[model samples]
Target: MRPGDIKILLVDDEASILQFLELGLRNEGYQVMTASDGLTAVNLVREFHHHIAILDVMMPGMDGFEVCSMIKKMAHTSVIMLTARDEIDDRVKGLKLGADDYVVKPFSFQELLARIEARLRNQFPHLLNEVTIGPFRINDQRKEILFNDSMLSLSNTEYDLLRYLVINHGIVLSKSKILDEVWGYDFGGQENVVEVYVSTLRDKLEDDDHVLIRTIRGAGYRIDLP
Candidate 1:
């Protein structure tokens, strides 16, 4: 999907950050949603499906990790955790808990935008090709994915991962392969990142009858074709 075609949910207790991000994203041509807390964010997820979410790790009610877990249980939503904590452990924990990416606080919005765009590009490279796999119909050119004739809202990372699996249906793609293919060389050997994305995708896509993507246990993942 095009960056402008993507819708993002921005969750933070800081009203200033929410306003800043919303304005920035909107100026970049993206549809943006804002929530001040985890409860509101979860409610928004249930109400309006968004392509991706930017969640603050520190909040009053529910923290980012809790919010991410909730989102993972819901749909194949891509989540990027924002935190002031720059510890490696914090980063690892977030990824292990199912976040697609991590951005440190005081980060450059330009970098965030770049990451979002890269994720989207990897997912919808064709951006205009109409293809179907099981109950899903994807129009790459149109930047749309439909499940049973209903539009499926996917985050930039989710869209890219799903599209990659669809394009390489029936092939076992190891975590390393997926990291390289989807995130490119700049991902710098982050294998855990691949696992997080795969887990998120499974949660979102497996709800339907056809299970197109499957885990290979100790190996990696594959797109199942019947």
Candidate 2:
């Protein structure tokens, strides 16, 4: 699924935890909805079909375990239960109650992110393969790119740059920022490299007039359909 297309639900009684996870996941490009209680979480899930739900096992009035079962019956959304207790019974109970995974409290964001991706890979594998933008199709698994049904041969650097541009399509990307993201921090002081690669990519894309990837004069480069 596209970043904007992948919706995730976050439920935690702790406002701090909800804020932390919402901000972190949003930066990673997922659409996030946070609830401070189980009822609100259920209401959100019932309203929108979220791809995943991260629920705290303990809550007032209703708990994560109760929320998980309700979510499963209401929507196909996958559940990842969270808790401060690392008890086996808690894990098993959450799993048995329709939570796809269980995460102990104090877990690193990276670990939770890994589990979220694992669930996506299993349940929504198509999201991993093809991400289409305008006339471009990027297949990260095969390391291949297709434009207008024509597969383009590209070096690793070129491929990364193109994918980055396609991902953030229509946004002006400054040379310094491109250098940092596409070429790494070690590529600092090499702004000219961005020009060279853009030139090559334009040529390969048959965009001789720079219509596909336009130079924003004094600003930077932006890709827009001609």
Q: CA lDDT of each candidate?
A: 0.79, 0.87
Write down the RMSD of candidate 2 (Cα, Å): 14.3
Model 2, range 82-162, lDDT digits (tens) per residue? 999999989988888888888888899999987887677546645676766679887888888999999999999999898
lDDT of 2 at 81: 88
Using all chains and alpha carbons, the TM-scores for the candidates as numbered come to 0.58, 0.58
lDDT of 2 at 2: 63
Model 1 bad stretches (over 4 Å): 122-226
Rate residue 197 of model 1 by lDDT: 74
Report the lDDT of model 1 for residue 109.
Answer: 94
Query: What's the number of clashes in each of the models?
Result: 7, 1
